[model samples]
Target: MTPTAAPVLIVEDDRNVLDITSFVLESAGYPVLTAMNAEEALLVLAGHPEVGLILTDVNMPGQMDGIDLVRRLRESGNPVRCVVVSGDALHAADRLGDLAPFLAKPYDRRSLLGAVQAALVA
Candidate 1:
């Protein structure tokens, strides 16, 4: 499927953040799916092959955080694009390198949507 037409999976541990992000994307007319952690995100991806983008938080309560999740997907040859969000931008950028785009925590709706759109097209 074309990335623009596919769903965006948001993986975040915070309920408030997840809900708000989902709401923002959905309100803007993008299809969205959500998971609270990397494991759940993996499961959701397995079931939803149409998910073209993943917007995941770097820190989460699970065996694997967003970085590991992205790494695993890469190792397995999953081509789904990713946009990672974290409060610690420098640390996350150092760890992520060119793996995915990074968005800082407490982002405004426009920034969040812009990052997602950029990733989708990338």
Candidate 2:
């Protein structure tokens, strides 16, 4: 799917990260939806069927982290794609496996945009 085909839901607890991510995606011409945590992300997911991708922070402060959120979505057969962003890149693969691409924190603009584009297309 193209980046603009559907809105990208960004799940981040950090205010600055959320703002930066949203700005970057918006500037890149992709529509964005923001959620401060996993619960909010789930709520947004329930409300917005047009969402195509979920870009989430791995270590969010909620009943479920990003990994858990993605797993839940998978278990429920949600087809929406996802990308997990985290500072701890080492364990991301083991924790998330093939569920989604893992983007390390401090990712550059080009890398972030590339990952998002790849995820959307995949």
Compose the digit string of candidate 1's lDDT tens values, residues 62-101.
7999999999999999999999999999899999999889
The weakest ten consecutive residues by lDDT in model 1 span: 1-10
TM agreement with the true structure for every prediction: 0.96, 0.95
As a TM-score, model 1 comes out at 0.96
Candidate closest to the true structure, highest lDDT: 1
Off by over 4 Å in 1: 1-3
lDDT tens digits, residue span 22-46, model 2: 9999888889999999999999999
Q: Each model's number of backbone clashes? A: 0, 0
lDDT of each: 0.92, 0.91
Off by over 4 Å in 2: none
The alpha-carbon lDDT assigned to residue 58 of candidate 2 equals 90
